[model samples]
Target: MGKFDDLPETRRRGLERMEQVYGFDMTDGTGDFFRYTADHLFADIWERPGLSDRDRRLLLIGLLSGSGGADVLGIQVPAALAAGELDAEELREIVIFLSHYAGWPNGARINSIVENAVAQASRPPK
Candidate 1:
């Protein structure tokens, strides 16, 4: 079996989850990035036996905060809320908790970014 066919169910669920979380579209003929993301990152890594989606979200939040990934956070933060992986309060707590480990500046910056995203997600479309 091929890589995708190796775990068909896992691949399918991973693809669906990936789309739900990141709006990842492979249809535009983008490049290897999307293909790899779908086939590997989501299909393989995300389908691993352990670590719930919520766990992944929290990790991504911290990782992104330290790595200067505001653009990615714009997608992840709101999706976490919408998917019930996290609520606004939990995200706020994460920022506060991460502040010590990730340092004051980075945590504060992430807090601001996440808060704005939460607000936007809560607002009705204009």
Candidate 2:
């Protein structure tokens, strides 16, 4: 097993969750970026005991919201909800709070993304 496989179960679950949410694969033009993300980002950084998954979810939402990274939120918002890292109401609140700091346009877009994710997450699994 490599470093990715050696990760703790919680970290492993996170990696699998990321792949599921993003449709990540080596052949999808991500290649080393995928491997590095699994190995370094999720397996290493996310596995650290300092922060809870909920905290990481909040931080990621803040960063993505401030940076206008809607593409990322497309995957992350629902996944965060699915993983119990965040709830629909909290997501709405985050958008409202970030609007003041990150600008209205950014927060509005993030709100739209979160709304869509909420809808999708509420659907029954196929």
Candidate 3:
């Protein structure tokens, strides 16, 4: 059996949800940080009601932009696109809109990441 085969229901649900959100398998992650991420962050926080996944994605994009979370955005942008949570046009517009508030440098970085993600998505898999 795999390492997480006997995980509790919450952790199991979190791992499932993580794959749904990120568009990739999450079971390969290990250690305490990954444990808490699946157990709490994904299970409790992301599963909370009142906000759709798309809503959360948009909110997270803004927060990431403001905080200069380019690295995280590198992950999030592609996931958002793959999940159909945000399209390239909407993403480009977000960068334009956020440029005024999040600062030009940060916005520019996000714009580049968004474009790259879009480009990568359009390419046929090797």
Candidate 4:
């Protein structure tokens, strides 16, 4: 089972249906959004023409975590962990940065959500 397997049937069907509708020759976790973000978004968009992926990842972590995207950040956190790119302190720092700029309430909310997301991994691993 892959990461998508952990999701419910409804979401699985939804993503799959979207794939079928778009006529993309890909599986549930291999659609354009996922592929583009993982490959192009990271390798190309983040990699830039010269900037490092580390910098890009930090920027992305900040961008996602800072702008009230705890939900999205929650998802990416796992991806970052899977890729061995994120550390606890760094993740905490992203939340801290959000608190400064994105407002404390939003950042705190994200922190709670992030805590839950991190706990999710320890819960059976899907």
Candidate 5:
């Protein structure tokens, strides 16, 4: 069995959904990092007691927003949505917070990325 099988039923289901929705396959071309994430991050770290998925997503958003990495923000936004942990408005506020410290160019780029992701999320499912 894969590492995802070790989690509780609900968390296992969630991880499978994440793999499908985000195309996050450890056995894909990428190497150890993906395997680590599959075996440890999701199956172990994120499954830890007392931390809700929403809180983790929010903390990630805070870190990403502060760093102002548009590409990461772009990719992670959908994951946030899929996690059902963060929505558009909270993400908007994250951009606003980033703007203060990360500057206009970075913040604006992140905002655009977030907007695009939110738009994609709103699109009718295929």
Candidate 6:
């Protein structure tokens, strides 16, 4: 059997959910942090039924902006676009809307991240 064959059901579910959310395979990671991320964060939290992925993404964007989590946003912004959870226009609008609450600097940072992700998405495969 391959490495994942022995994984607990939650870990397996989490890895699948991670791929669905991020538009990429996430099975290569190791260690307890990776395990907890996949098992708890993705499986238990993200898989909850009350909110759609887009809704979660929007909430996460606000939290990230408020906390100055630009690096995580760098990953999430692009993944969110790739997953078709948010379009470029909506992302730009988020920048404007969030600017008022998240502060100008955080909004500017988010704007740059969103613009870059949008630009990257528009590029032809090389």
Q: For each candidate, what TM-score against the reference? A: 0.77, 0.75, 0.91, 0.55, 0.70, 0.90
- How close to the true structure is residue 12 of candidate 4, measured as C-alpha lDDT? 52
> By summed lDDT, which 10 consecutive residues of candidate 2 come out lowest?
21-30
Prediction 1 TM-score vs. true:
0.77
Best by lDDT: 3
- Candidate 1 ranges with C-alpha deviation above 4 Å: 1-14, 23-28
The models' CA-based lDDT, in order, is: 0.76, 0.76, 0.91, 0.59, 0.70, 0.90
> Distance (Å) between predicted and true CA of 32, model 1?
2.1
lDDT of 5 by residue, 13-70 (tens): 5466457535455333246776565556665676678967678766776677777666
Residue range 9-51, candidate 2, lDDT tens digits: 6446557645654444322224777667765776567768998
Q: Between prediction 2 and prediction 3, which has the larger TM-score?
A: 3
Those runs of model 6 whose alpha carbons end farther than 4 Å from true positions after fitting are 1-3
Q: Rank the candidates by lDDT, best first.
A: 3, 6, 2, 1, 5, 4
Pick by TM-score: 3 or 4, better one: 3
Query: Candidate 5 — what's its lDDT?
Result: 0.70
Query: What tens-digit string does per-residue lDDT give for candidate 6 at 7-120?
Result: 888888888888888786676478999988999999899989999999999999999999999999998899999989999999999999999999999999999999999999
Clashing pairs in 5: none
CA deviation > 4 Å runs, candidate 5? 1-30
Clashing pairs in 6: none
lDDT of 3 by residue, 6-96 (tens): 8888888788888888888777467999888998999899999999999999999999999999998998999999999999999999999
For model 4, residues 1-126, the per-residue Cα lDDT tens digits are 744467655445454433332233334455677655444443344434675545655676678765777666665665565455666566677778778887888888767855665666457853
